[model samples]
Target chain A: MNNPLLSIQSQYWAVRDYLSPEFVAAGDFLTFKFPVWQWEKGDPSRARDFLPHDKQYLITRNVPCLRRATAVNYTDADEDAEKLLSFLDEAEEVAGPDGKPRGDDDWVATHIGRGQLPYLRITPLPTQPLANLNIKDTADEQIDEIPDMDEIPDMDDEAVGLEEEDDAVRIVHPSAAEVNSTAGQNLLQVRTYDCLISYDKHYQTPRFWLYGYDEPLADSAEQNPLTPAQVFQDVPADYAFKTMTMEAFPHSGQQLASVHPCKHASVMKKFIDRMEAAQPTEGEAAPLTSGSKKGKWGIGGMVRKVTGGSAPPADKKEKEPSGDGEGSSGVQVDFYLVIFLKFIASIVPTIEVDSTTATAL
Target chain B: MAPLQFQPLSSQPTPSFWSALNSLKLDKLKLDDSEQPMEAWLEESREIHDREKGGTIGVSGSVGLGSGAFGQESGERPPAGSVELKGVFKNYNTIEEFKATETKKEIFNSVADSILASFETNAPQLDTFLLVTFADLKKYIYHYWFAFPAVVSKPAWEIEEGGLVAAEDQLVAEARKLADDLSNRSGALLVRGPAGQRTAAPVKDATAFFEGVPSSERIVAFHDPSHLPDAPGWPVRNVLFYLASKHGLSDVTILCLRSGSSSRIGRVSLPGPLSAEKPTFVGWERNKIGKLGSRVADLGPMMDPARLADQAV
Candidate 1:
């Protein structure tokens, strides 16, 4: 499965399908069990068959977004300038000319400003039923079981409803202390986005599609399908204006905001190259997941170990697996989407979308 | 206490809804600009937060699942019966067709006529729906508007002393269970008697339910979409009009049913119950800024081949 001969499209599919032997995410709170990215065939009712059957999309749901993107308090990752420069200087001496760009794009998102919100309005929910119901099931069940509501105007703008762009509007939940005292109050109105990773055949890289369900949408008591304008506001301003486009969901045809895939491959190539250049560690594994240089202590000396071939390759490598597992051997093309999502989390840093623990590299 | 204010439901037609309209035009109704039938429904309001007390509010209840909502059904669930109300879709052949003052007036009149018909039968009907659009198919941009014609009562109704109070759990549970049936789902109910001794029956039985019971015990319950404690969803307002016009009853109790989980019963006494006259209506959903203009959804960025081809990997 680690064959260097497969095309990038096949490689992306391989990563999604493979049950990684090294990925023992069982007890890890930061990650899902295994096979983090599940493959989907999308809607069978699709009139056109433009994309391949199995690789149509990839999804990971119920990602929690705790605070508004505007509320994010970020400390610049550029703070440790000296440590970052030396790591790049080492890559420059080892990988020759191409190493300079590797450190720049992969870590810049950690320093970026980001925020999130989908439309919300409070209408008192029945207190009892929501307790035993699974969040996902409750949403689907109410569509079938519950009756439709009468048209009520949105009058109390302040007491209920999330402002599409106001910072003064804070999130409140029934489970939160004050409301909890009154039992049958509203549930925690947490804004959670159902992050969907779809493969856009046109761009040929893994494309991203996201649908945000409000607490009511999540609870199945209301139908506030997010608008295209609301979806744009959830993403960073830079990406929203430039790279973001409101595209129809390939399966449901509901319009959702998707991150344009034209430049995804180029940025992904940086991490792959960085992984292939550094040698397999024998004793303790370094946390390459760091945006900083904490685990890169011996990489310069390990660089000359005749690492087979640099990844993101026009040139191929036939390196054998150092199968003791624990990612002692760096970078399998199988870890692409994990790394892809890491890059995505950078720009749209507000959505806590991934739990894949990008340490798979 | 303050007088009650009615919240209006704004029609949120998804991009899929627009895409479906685009397809319906291309494959099915090419040149025909006549009305096409659609099923649109409303959503319930879920809460009344204490800190931000709305003196009264209008809950935007309708989630108009238009043409796009028809065909694609999910694997886990059957076709949804979600607030299945009749929606009349009139796609104007051109923007001029949409802009014609007479055309908009005629659409409004058609909805008004339906409200009159519902009042005549005293039947449970959510027949009030009107949608007009001009879809620029080639460009993938859509211009559309939805009109929920709520008949303006001659003398707007007022709330009685003592604001809405939570109905007993037993009645709420009974009303909720009956609501699961699609037939019962659209109609209002009459809950008679005190908490444990109450009997919940459809509004069709209001004549019998109120026969022996006092006006104090005969309470009306309908699905509400407003969470503001002061307001009930808009459908009940028409029900109020219907009861006034048909039964000659002006004073009654309204159990503002929020979702199916709970109920807030209050007395909304209307004086000089409305008679079936050519009903005057007042429901044109305000736009994002509370304006009376149509909204345009441009999917050109995603649909235009030129844009997709802009960046070649």
Candidate 2:
């Protein structure tokens, strides 16, 4: 279809609707295959010693389906500073065991973790059964029978004009063209937080068990590997989970510590609201579906008209529709995951500490 | 301090601090009402008779009235469930007085300063909320996130009809994106008019107003219902409760409404993570509610964590 000059939000909804449940669920690590990056001498990525196999580490266990290659890259061309701000805004400000005053013990970690393992409490993604899927259908059989774009309704115009100030939704997901753009090549692998779910017996509330790691990738000269102890210094005293304690896993053999609770559920609920707001309204027109279009309004007809009455290139016309065939769900799941992580990052306990202070020493 | 030691879930036997407190038998007083039924009556009689001579009790009054010396012969009556509060009407009186003495700019500055000052002192460390009501002719709602400077923030101190709508839209957009981020959600509420001016106001539609503001996740709402005209005189207690229930919030730190007549703000029961059965209520200036400064941290999730442990197990 002709590019409808869709805004970031419109694009986000298109991508969300384009995905099916099976594709989102397929984001599990069992079937993940990493894309090869350019190797350089003395690069940290060469550190095979600390690199745990995919299954061994918690970060890689539930790999997000959307990779840098498949997703749309929305980073602005101008303002590298703004891009960095976005990164810093969304990066987990963890103070692991590596920073400041070589103390007898790390107070920051102990204070927040309530134990050796500091939890990263993630809000679970909202899961809905596919519209066409049935319980009895086999996975292989159902994959081929996914619905056409025409079947899905568009967002309601009234919903778009919702006067609520809280209706703003940011689209961080990259589209196929955007991802392939020149600016997308240098993008860094987004950091994934390591955490386990735990419980606070006193309040009887669920808690995140933060497990710190060095960095996102092995090869990176600019980034510093964060020790588990270093992650706590950045945590503010008032975060909700900062006051929780959890039972250590059977094999961890870690000591118990006090916790400082952070109210992360509030953050999670906000994400849930955003997803709710982005939902497609009933009876709205499907913008890109050819079946819904008439005459020259169709993408092919529009492309033909643009090409000055000459036939459009066969290869260009053959390019499958925006969200169809393989990897669309992977793209969708990855996009949602990124959004979730960004929301999670915005609330994580990260208090700025002055390096010049005596406390740092 | 020594490092806290971790133990496996199966091996840990210590009860949580909350569980230990709950186990105590502090519900009923040691002395029963039946045991001390007449004990209170005897103490009261002694006080009346123990005074010095010519204490203005029996010297000027009649010595005989029926069988008793004094006319107040009936037994003490039990306390009333609710009192006839000098609130909405009192507030109206106060607003009139305020308008007579203070300019609109002064009222705005004082109200804004009161709210900003509260963020440092009265505000809870987490999940703070406040609602400031004013008696303005134009009905506008101004909101701010405490993380930003209270002054020069969007929907400035001055009341603007267009700004109120713009502020609502901005808040809704931010709330949608950030969800519960402190920088995006926690802030003040500036409502035009005092508690009683209910007709044709933006805030009359409780659902829309409550939903528009970040009531569900706000840590503080600086309420000042100062200049409401023709009001029925009801406190903004119902609106506060509505915001609390939206997020299933159990604990919230609210600023009591200020009256034009009194310098002192009304009292609100700032409880320590109160149970749902006993909700927080705002009291009049003289009749303060719960204890002062019962500040609490964010209570986190509403559900029991034991169920989560079971599910994980």
Candidate 3:
């Protein structure tokens, strides 16, 4: 073999470790598992530097769930939803002259550690978008974290968001201000999921697991760990039915509900092509220039409000990769997990687990 | 001022702890429902650094137990850099046994007896938890509950909330070292200080430690896992009981030494107390859903033979 060195690891395996200042402000943190099945100590085939080099899995714990996936109005994504506009206006007025949002105390309280009881938040999981909304069944709606509304290249990209309109949970993460104020803390309860990403030796792709907890019933105050069926309520219908399976976590051996990675490579490839295509065009990198100064949460709401429907939503166009995708201009292998999470966010719509801003490296 | 109430500290059982229980079941104690000694720990307060960068905040500590908890005789105190948590884990032979409230109450009474005995012997301790569990070997799901008992003061303890504040780096460092120190962990513990100068010594030795120390410096420091801005964690309540009843102190200062994040310190008043015979107490951990009942971890979906067979392909 050309390389027997354990230090010579996959470029993508190393990138998963570089997640930035994770949730110290957000009350969440990463849990890392070291590789277990390593070459024996005296084995001659063992790589020189160390035996088990790469991390086996990465877990971001207590990802607070403030709302349920079903609460997101998919119709809002296709329409000029006026309800959210006034809230956006409040954010804009309070935003600094340069568009950077000032740290408003109430805003922080509502978003940070505002874990409302996720069980109470759940409505029955909608398997398909309500046909009455008139949203196109074939529309490849973009995820909600996009930076600019105008950035969506009309239609027909090679890579569509994993969230196909009919089969997916919509991506519009309503700002805390968008929720009815009367619901208040009385309605909000804390339900959390532990999001785990592990490399699959069988599939050679990263596997995802979401372990969820639900509120105790009113009659008895005992713990009710989320059932597999209930956990899927947060998952988009397309992948929920087909890809998710209950499996043993390799590192902890805790039998947990998991998202199988069999189709991850195909979805990730489309993601790469689109991300690369979106990278080259500074075409009116106009909105984000002023928008980024507004901080992470404000980036989308501000852009959507500013665009107000004259422009298309923030979807990416996936032109066929110009063959040179493997070159220096290709997506950094380090950023593989970030994009994986971004796409995964579409699949599990209510989780506040991913920390990536739109300019994802 | 508000009645001093402690936010119940959650039991954070590490994967290894659960796995350790699994090994105990599979190898040695398959059907044995006897109690076994276990060692759990609370972390010493860390310096203020991570929170400013990551903006994360919450309860900073839990009764953290790992693999080494079982199968060995443990000392009364945890080693340095850790706070004392001497616990006992009882594995029931069946889920029915695990759910028996009468049996649970008897076990709880034993824990309370030990707490009272420890206090009576002039070595008061509140770092005790009772874990009643049932591990499903075939399915790999575990059902468990934790109870941390604390004696209630007769008239109730009043608290003045000390909102979140940046801990003095040097003072917290010295106090953290003492809280984690083996020699200082036993008996009642307190950190006496005069601004920059502070030291951790047994509460019994509070009189000696404060020879040159000011009255404002008599601070009882405990490893607190509470995330709330005002209320301290459960373990501190009995300490307050000891301080108010035994030591004859009315107003007390407490340092809720939270690890890995900010620590809260506040002044509390022991309003009225004096019933030594059989003190009243309250403790029973609520399930994750905030209810006082049993919680389930269903592993059939993952570990069932049929599912395993399906995934093998």
Candidate 4:
């Protein structure tokens, strides 16, 4: 841990030994063929002019993954050719059962594997050049109409000199700081390191260990890069918590119960007071319950039952009269006397009765 | 020679005595013949007799000789030759003496002169004269002169311890009698009289009276004590009294003839107690013809009394 060089050397050895058989078999297919033209000499006109068809052919050729420290000088033209031949040798070892050449699978295993190959690193080109394409003459010209680029200053480096040196090794075991920084910039780059591996059957290129990375090509431009949890803190507070898990309930049971007792007890007391105030005074009976025997009739059940039973019993028997016979007889006599008096009065005038017996006497 | 009874000498020719006796007979005959006859000889003799018998003569003498002999007498006289010669001789002298007297001619001349004088004083003078011929003076007297009462004086019976009663009293009596008579006849009374006199009677239907006068005659009514001076002339006074009585109007006005400067007429308004006191003089403001004459030509026709009374009531 004191020196990371040893760990980097060990990581390389492990990758090499593990891939030696496949590498030796890849070497058997190696051929020292020059490119149709050399583009590294700065004679762009004499170069092969890799049109879209040539780029496609190169991608399908199943080139091998080389130990970039030993076989290639990334900036040298001859070294790039030797590394390309080595990639072809490794592609031949992982040829399919049909055995002509493994196509893109062998090309991916030998040259594009995560740990074993270091022929090329695809770093993103600076986007500021394209954004500032309208800035003429090194962006320092002070023409009257020139836009104020200070409002949008360029941050890209002026010169990034990438040189090929013989001691420069492609270390598969990068420092954690480097890994974290690069992975923080884009999740796909981190995910590519974590999930991609070289296969013996397709030793020339790296294949995605997890199929999740094999997204539709059409959606690639519209997708947002994955961000870490720490980035969420920069969003507005209200929205920040909206995505977080709830910690605990905001109210206790005792507090809820206490509120209910006062509210519900007061409501019940008002209901009882309303009912009592609505009741009728003494000597004023409640209205008859007309539809069903529910409240009023149910309350007078004993009186109704006794009256019902006594009425049937009295109906069966010829009961004695309630009042005295003398009083009843007097009432009968009074009734007859009124009728007799009315009749007698009506006939008295025509009867010619003696005056002594008449009421006028 | 005692009263000279000369006998008729049949043997001797006695011409002088015969001529004298013939002259006496002619005078007697002449007196009998006064009118012209149809025949020429009778006409000539009648003219001669007319001249001799004061221009008119009454036939006289024996009935037979005086043209009474004819049963139906004509206006003609007998022929001169038909008269007895002796009758002619006796009437000839009488005719001469009758003509010399001229009694009838002289009486007519006096009457005519009196009439002409009255006209000069009373009537409006005319440029052209008109002569009215009457058969006799009695006819003129009956028709024009004495047709109305000679003087409108109160009746003798109306004198009650007085000199003269008021004209109104007489007028009222007359109007009442008229109204009574009119009522009896089923007609109305129309009294047109002087102004101060009652024009209406106290009858059951006594209505109204209107004041105005007919314009032909000149009248002169006077209320002032002083008589009008003569320079304005008598016609002015006459017309004044007439208009005052007839129309119950007052005020005097004069007009002159357009044809002559000296010739003029005058009018005076009559007064009426029952009429409007102030009377209007309707005449031309200026004498355009340089003569003082009234523009008022004539009063319109008189209003019917009964109709006027009906309107008043």
TM agreement with the true structure for every prediction: 0.54, 0.19, 0.59, 0.11
Sort the candidates on DockQ, descending order.
3, 1, 2, 4
Tens-place lDDT digits, model 1, residues A16-127: 3322212211112112222334444455576235545543455544344443444343323353233334444454343443432232222323533222122232122223
DockQ, each predicted model: 0.02, 0.01, 0.16, 0.00
| Candidate number with the higher lDDT (3 or 4) | 3
Model 1 chain A poorest 10 in a row by lDDT: A164-173
lDDT of 3 by residue, A260-291 (tens): 87777776666555444443232233344422
In candidate 2, what are the lDDT values of residues A92-125, reduced to their tens digit?
Answer: 1111112121221111111221222222232221
Model 1 Cα shift for residue B307 (angstroms): 2.6
Tell me how far candidate 2 lies from the true structure as C-alpha RMSD in angstroms: 32.3
Higher-scoring candidate on DockQ, 1 or 3: 3
lDDT of 2 at B256: 23
Candidate 1 local distance difference test against the native = 0.50
Compared with the true structure, what per-residue lDDT tens digits does model 4 show for residues A1-361? 2222223323323332223232222221111111110111111222222222111111000011111122211123343234334433432232212322222221111112223224344322324532243243223224411442331112121001111111212111223344345433321111100011111222321111110111101122111111111111121122222322111111100000001111222322332232223223210342342211111111111112212222232231222121122110111111111111111111111111111111000
Q: lDDT of each prediction vs. the true structure?
A: 0.50, 0.22, 0.50, 0.20
User: Model 4 misses residue A328 by how many Å?
Assistant: 99
- lDDT tens digits, residue span B1-313, model 1: 3455675555656444666777788988899988876766665543211111211122234454533344434211111223555667789888766655567777777777877787667564544677888877775667676776666666567678777777766677665555564254463666667665666766655676678777766677776755555567666766776666666657788876664234587887765555445556655554433445455555544454554353221
